[model samples]
Target: MSILIDSAVVLKSYNNNIVSVTINEEERILFAKGIGFGKKFGDKIEKGTEVEKIFILEDEDNLRNFKQVIENVDENFLILCETMISYIENELKEDLDERIHVALVDHLNFAVQRLSNNEEIENPFLMEIKALYEKEYTLAEKVAETLQYEKGVNIPVGEIGFIALHIHSARNCGKLSNTLKSTHLINSIVEYVEKQIEVQIDKTSLDYARFVTHLRFAIKRILSDISIKNDFIKEIKSKYKLSYKIASGVSKILIEQLQKNVTVDEIAYLAMHIERLRIATIDK
Candidate 1:
């Protein structure tokens, strides 16, 4: 007695605890009792809460498609969602609620648009992105809690999910502009650092990239307040001795050549830091 559903069906919330999902010739409305992590849906749905869910359908074909779609789409959606959540968490620092709401809306709209316009989205990269999108709310909520409960900042699950969706949509549309702000910037920087490390480090690239990402976060935390000063170099070296040299060197080269018009001194410093790390490693 397994319920059948279309994996491709669109899940739409209609303002109440009600959600209307449509797939093929089958459509159904289910009351969202509560949709948060670790919560099970029964006969009712909450008005607006992030939730993990499965749609029930009476059609066998729909069910088969649903299984296939979930299997294919889940991985990419999760990554996309995590990236977006990270972006929003970094940007909407003080205004958690509004940021999350707008981000989620923007993301969903973007996703629908992409599916309509693009062809052959079954590519590995696209798949990864979709996987990210699937876990948008959970990742966001966890990120918010980590940032807030652990670091004393407030970011809600709704806002995080929204941002996650927004980033996913933008990425799908080949638009990096939507992710150029705040936490998104952090995400971008992490990406840049990771890429550089992979390019330079070769065999140990992933490991190095992981290290650099954490290093970036730590640096951001340590230098969150002060105006960028030349001492930035000294601080990084002291804080992250191993990667600092290469990272700083990379940072400087990027700032001078690529980011010439960019004025964020912090970014400049980061570029330089990455460069320095690369150079120091090479010299050794």
Candidate 2:
């Protein structure tokens, strides 16, 4: 099968001779390898330039194959897939618009991959990526809570569903880091807080995941503090008396080093300190 480039494309980068080509329309990137000679001079393929190459794929199959590759390469592909499902659910019609879904997913994936350097993904080296995604998910939940408390705005459930998708995919990958696993535990506590507060926090803002990540790291530091100093648990429990059970669970696990003398007051302080630090650092 032969594929045609419909416009001037930038050589975003090259790996082992395979060029990552970018154009405006179709997000199905061109992976032309070893085309040889002058093509490497980076001539202006121009906005209207067209080149044909032979490959073992037709149009539809090529799109599907590229998407599958993306899914394997970037776990975040599930987020895109879920977004389309959400669209289908919200649509009033019985039959969902498949074409629109495909185009949107491809475009969104292409944009995010470049921003996140997601295309640089390694096949057998996905462990770090899985940890990164989970860390981001757990933190997103916390930031959502912080926003709701500070701004009186509730985070949308769709975004939480998306974050949940990331968490599930990361857990399924089974390569989370110790820090990410700790964040998972903290996420459960934050989720309980969200329920107690009776409010939803939206994470639709740009860079929301990044904000969550910072909070997670900051909160992790607090956990380290609790482990090092025995009094953190008692403080937190006293502060969030209504959330004492949830706070206590976090204290018991995080401050296991303290042993036997953990108190609600220390745990309450730990939560309060973490929230204060998170607000001081994360962007609004």
Q: What is the TM-score of each candidate against the true structure?
A: 0.26, 0.26
Residue-level lDDT of model 1, residues 81-105, one tens digit each, is 4344445546544223222222343
lDDT of 2 by residue, 1-284 (tens): 23354553434332322233444533333333433224543333444333332122224533444444444434334333433344333442343322223333443344344424434211221333235455544544553454356435455433433333333332332334753565576566446545644444333322223333333433433533322233445555556455555446555655553234444445554456444434433433
Using TM-score as the measure, the top candidate is 1
Stretches of model 1 off by over 4 angstroms after superposition: 1-31, 35-192, 195-233, 256-284
Structural RMSD, model 1: 16.7
lDDT of 2 at 42: 39
Model 1 poorest 10 in a row by lDDT? 119-128
Model 1 / residue 67 / CA error / Å: 18
TM-score of model number 1: 0.26
